[model samples]
Target chain A: MVDLNVFTTTTIYASVLALLSLGITLIYMTTRVFNFAHPRLSLVAAYAAATFMAIYARSAHLKPNLEPAETSIGYVTVPFPASFYLVGVVAATVFGVVAALVEYYAILKPLLRRGADYLKLMIATLAYDFILMAVLFLYNTHRAVKSALSNPLRLTPTSLSMTAYDVSIVTEGGTFIAGMFIFSAALAVALAAALYLLLYRTTLGVKMRASIENPPLAEVLGINVERIYAIAWILSGATAGLAGYIMLFATSAGSLKPISATSPADEIVVSAFAGSIVGGVNSIFGSIAGGLLIGYAETYVTQLLQAITGYPEMFQYARVVSMAIVALTLLFAPSGLAGLLRSPRARRLLSRIPVPGRARGGGR
Target chain B: MEEPIIVVDKVNAGYEKLQTLFDVSLEIPRGKITVIVGPNGAGKSTLLKTLFGLTKVYSGRITFEGRDITRLPPHERAKLGMAFIFQLNNVFAELTVKENLRLAGHDLPASVLEERIREVFETFPRLRERLDQKAGTMSGGERQMLAMAIGMIRKPKVFLIDEPTAGLAPKLAREVLENVRKLNEQGYTIVLVEQNVKAGLEIGDKGVLVVSGRIAFDGPAAELLARKDLAKMYLGIS
Candidate 1:
């Protein structure tokens, strides 16, 4: 019998990781830069959600009586409104977009104009990661001082979590799934679908593909490559932000048992990069698969290793597992699983799937 | 002749550290084909790229129809009725032929774009047959034709074509040259860089021979074509 808890937890982790990997893939495809600061974008978003939730919690606070209760009564802790969570996601998304634009206009654009080498550009993004991480830390410290709320660095957003309504079933041995798990998973699916439509069916999508194919020609054809790049950045940032907000819930609800943000986004980022590489950075769908594969592996492998070795601390080797996956993927299949699907046989197989706008007999 | 449509006045340009064009100037007469010919290290291609605002102009002025466009970006120049077709990677390879045409006519209204696309399809029937085929899959000659068709869709005042016949069969090369002549007949001022000196000079109204980052001769195409001494001395042709 499979552990239902581990399965659900893996699904939740994979869902948010898929979102983050998609964001990573989007920015890489358009700009030809691997943004090391991408994980920080999510952290900023999580902070934004946390900030909004803290504000709401403060507003809804009930001042405790200085005198002791006659029977030592316990005051009830009410959950924040569902609308507050939505507002938090929105706030996080906006902040993510703004941060991405600032990084583009203020740092990345100047480096590109100066014809900085790829290594220099990469280092610049690393610097940006630390800079933004410092900003998140400072903001966390500031919030702790300004409102007397829980410390962000020490306490996860679980301290201000919305109540989870579980849906229990009387089937087989009795099944149970938390409402938050379903909600976050649905959001991930919707985001991926929206991205697919935007990339394949719209005028902006055509422009984006043209620019990605050949930037100079696209520019000559009057596609406004700069604007397309800006759009890519915004989309990447927004997706990263939304993923971060969802991750807070996933972690708080204990649905992503394998991962949680303790200090910053270092661990989640490692898994995301590993997943992106395994999925093939060029294909959005591939990233989703890669993320899920890593998500499941991280959870199950750690459990199996711990059970076999009788070492409770064996879960710490999960990062090692991700590193190994990345190395093996690069060595054996440099193009990733998506690259394999690009083969003639795989393409022919896919062609039979009856997708719209993909009529056969066209030249490759 | 009828006030040159684009005038390059003593331009010095290059890419990054190395200078490629030194004090070169030329005038492109309206609705006429001007061919640039030179030996292998001459600044022929650079001259065309510089006029289209692709290279870094260290010092000089480029005036298009009496408007100073030296400082304009490539797309801005493209908007102002100038089209550049490179020797390689001229079209969006990943896109289908129809998508490529649509993208070229991005500024046009949908109805107008459809009409213009139909016009291009009529001009190049082979492209019409392969409308849904990706551009990258086309043969070299067909790709060149598609490149020209994309330029035509833009309806530019001047066309800057570089090495249109560099990597084509003799028959296809001649066919491309004939299309260039046909385009000129339709009243497009053209700036062409070609390695096929005889055919290029025969079709051009004016010719500028560049050598070692300088223009060695600028005059009637027939005269430069006939001058064996100038041809052998600077153009590396008998």
Candidate 2:
């Protein structure tokens, strides 16, 4: 029988991963640049939320009383104002937008105007990622020192837990359902729906799609391609911010430690990129599928292998699954799942492959 | 002579650091088909692109309807009632025919946009039937019709078309030229660059032969076609 707790935690993780992958795919479609700083953009939001929660906790006189709870989860602290979590969410989203716009205007736009090729533009994002990491490091250290010296409530500036702030429901069957799971799932669905409506139903969305398909042709048709691209960046940043904020709950549910300042850039970036690539970097919805596949596989596959092999240490190798999947995707379907489904040539190739029951048609 | 709708005054333009059109001057009269033909790499398409502000103008002035537009960007030029149809990749291949028309009239009011789409349907009824079909799946001739229909949706004052029949079969090429003539008869000024020199000049009101980015001859279409020496030496026509 599958463990309910593990399933809930895995679903939460998959929802957040889907949002992150969608942001990456949207940015790629608009700018045609692989933004290495994108994961750091999410980290910016995570740090922003953590900092906001700390400030709110201090102001509300909530003493940092860390104790072990009855549950399997490790640490528990005094809950702050429930409304204060909203403040954290807002702060995360705003900071994400500001950071992304900074990358676009300060770095990407200037390089593009100077006629930098894709390689230089991509390298510029890498440099920007390093810069963000340094900034985040210094800020987290300063906050840690300041909180240690002056504040009675001692929260780690680099890491955060959302358990205290999260509301949970105990099922009649004695199962615990984390609020994060519901919130993340609902938000991901809402975001996907909103994006679909915006892209298909609105004039600005049509203009954006047109610009993405052919910028020069769009320009001749009087569409401001630059403005559409800026809007895309705004959407990318917003989604990244939401993903970062919700990720804290997944961390709390699974490992009992909140995501650290370095976690997104160091660990989650690989899975996010793998999701986008395996889903088809050119498709928005495909990236979501990619994210879910990677997220579930990373958790459940590790659990299954560990159980079968009687080795508890197999969880550490979970990321290898993502790497393997990415390699297979690139080898067989470089354009990703969307191409296999949509492109006639790819479909033809698929039909040619000999299946046990399916009759093959003659080659054109 | 009728008043020229577009006047290129000694325009020297090309892509960055490459000067293709050198001190070239021309005038396109209103309500007439002006055909621009030349040998390979003679900057025929470049001249069309220059007229639509797509190329870098080192030093020159292009006046459209008595307004200077040499410094305007392509979008701004488009807003000034000029439509440029490229030789290839002119249509958004991923978009449906209706979506392409909607994007062409992006800034129009909803009612006006619908009205314009209806007008476009009147011109090319095939687009109405294939309203939901992806443009990339359409045949070459149908794609050209859709491109023209997209241009027509905006009701632009002038059409700068570059090799509309570039890759089509000969029969379809003739049909496309016939459609161009029909568009001209409907009172839209057209400046067309064509590789099929004979067919292009046959329907052209004015003929311009550009050789190595220079205007070798500019006159009535019949007069230019009657010149056997220029036709044999430049156009490889008997």
Candidate 3:
């Protein structure tokens, strides 16, 4: 008997992680920058959503329902209007895009023009992440001060989770799934499909792919490679922002606990990095698969180890599974799952391993 | 006879602070192939890149059709009736052949691009057969043909081709050179850099020899080929 709750939770986490991984992979492909600040983009989105929801609830004169309803499995004490969440999503996405553009135009673009190498650019992104962290901390402190001075519903921007507002749907089998799970899963599929269409069906997509493969040639062919890169950054930021919003509700931690400005992002960066690397950093679709695999493995492997060891404390080391997966992937499949599938030699090697349903001489 | 299609007036250009071409000057005549031959590291490709606005020009003027274009970027030069084909990694290797052709004429009107692609197919029928194949999967000779075909899709007035036969077999090299001649015959001015000095000069209308970043000889191709002294001393054409 599989636990429906665990399945839903894992699905939500996988979807959000997939979005984050895609953002990282897209930015890397276009600019060749590791973008250490990418995880922070989601943090910005989460804060934006928190602030929007708080402001909207106050304006609408809705009482803050900080406690979960009896029927709900997760959070969402108040019956806030759907428009509140919509505004939050839009705000998060816009802020995400703005932060990404600032990183590119203000930092990466100037350094690139000055002929900075990959190492310098990566370090620059790391510096930008620290700067962003400080900015977010200041913003959080400001919000805290304002919330203390304000009237009724105590909503601090530093501590926010959409799960407090989420509704749960009970199934016929006496189980339930959070609405956030459905929303995150649906959004992931929609975004992936949209990206595929944009990259393969449209002329702009062809130009972008061309620029990614060969910028000099694309430039000589009269394509504005810089403009293409800017567009990619915008897309990457949007994905990160939306994923952050989704993550706010998807997380299963204490509803009332205050999360630090950086803690949520800090917790997920390794998993996101693992996903991108396991997918073969160069392949966007591969990153999505990698993210899902890592997300599931981190959860299920931890659960299995705890069950086997008969120790509940083993769950505290769940990230160790992700770390181990990253290490093993780097050692055995450095090119990633996509690269292995693409290479004839790798495919031949994989065929000889006699996996179930494996075809012989399938190398193309 | 007519004003040369492109005039490099004592141009000093190179990568950032490297200065590969030193006060070199040359003119590319209209409707003919001008071959640039030089020893290794003699800046033959740099000269071509300079003409295409790929390098930093320290000083001097480059006039294309009487318009000074010393500071224009590569894409702007491409828009102003110039096509540059690189020696390596010239095509979008991951893109399909059809996608490559479409991207080459990216700014063209749909009907015009379709017509141009058709004409390109007529010139290189092999590309038509491999329309769905990735450019990287093609043979070296086929890739060269596709590079030339991509240039043709633009219908530019001048083509700047760098070592189109750099790593090809002897037979394929000759075939590639023959295609360059055919492109010239179609009234497109060509500036080519070649390692095969004798074969390059054999197909060229004018030969410009460079040694240590300076032009050692610039004259009719047959005249340069006939000079046994200059050939043996610089080009190892004894």
The Cα RMSD across the true interface for model 1 is 2.4
TM-score of each model, in listed order = 0.89, 0.88, 0.91
Better of 1 and 3 by DockQ: 1
- Candidate 3 regions exceeding 4 Å error are A60-78, A143-145, A148-153, A171-174, A253-259, A343-364
DockQ of 3: 0.53
TM-score of predicted structure 1: 0.89
Better of 1 and 2 by DockQ: 1
Q: Candidate 3 docking: what grade?
A: medium
Error of 3 at A229 (Å): 1.2
lDDT, residue B162, candidate 3: 97
Error of 1 at B206 (Å): 1.7
Number of the predicted model whose TM-score against the real structure is largest: 3
**Chain A of candidate 2: what's the TM-score?**
0.85
Candidate 1 per-residue C-alpha lDDT over A1-364 given as tens digits, one digit per residue, 9 for 90 to 100: 6777667767777777777777788777787788888877877777676677556546756232223222222322223445666667788899888878888889989998777877887888888888987776566556453354453222343233322312222223445454456666787778768878987788888888888888888877767788999998998899888777766656532233311223336767888888788889988778877877787787788788898999998777877777788898899888887888887999888877876655665434
lDDT of 3: 0.85
* lDDT at residue B170 of model 1 (Cα atoms): 96
Cα lDDT for residue A9, model 3? Answer: 83
Per residue, candidate 2 scores C-alpha lDDT tens digits across A1-364 of 8988888888888887788888889989989998888878887887787677667767776654434244444233324446667877898899888988999999999988667989999999999899998988787779464474235434466665555556565554567777788888788788879888998889988998899999989989988788889998998898888887887555743222365557745777888898899999999888888888888888888888998999989888878988888999999999887877878887878887788745422221
Instruction: Name the weakest run of 10 consecutive residues (lDDT summed) in model 2 chain A.
Output: A71-80
Give, for candidate 3 chain B, the lowest lDDT window spanning 10 residues: B125-134
Weakest lDDT window of 10 consecutive positions for candidate 1 chain B: B116-125
Candidate 1's displacement at residue B183, Å, is 1.5
Candidate 2: list runs displaced more than 4 Å.
A56-82, A143-145, A148-153, A160-163, A252-261, A343-364, B1-3
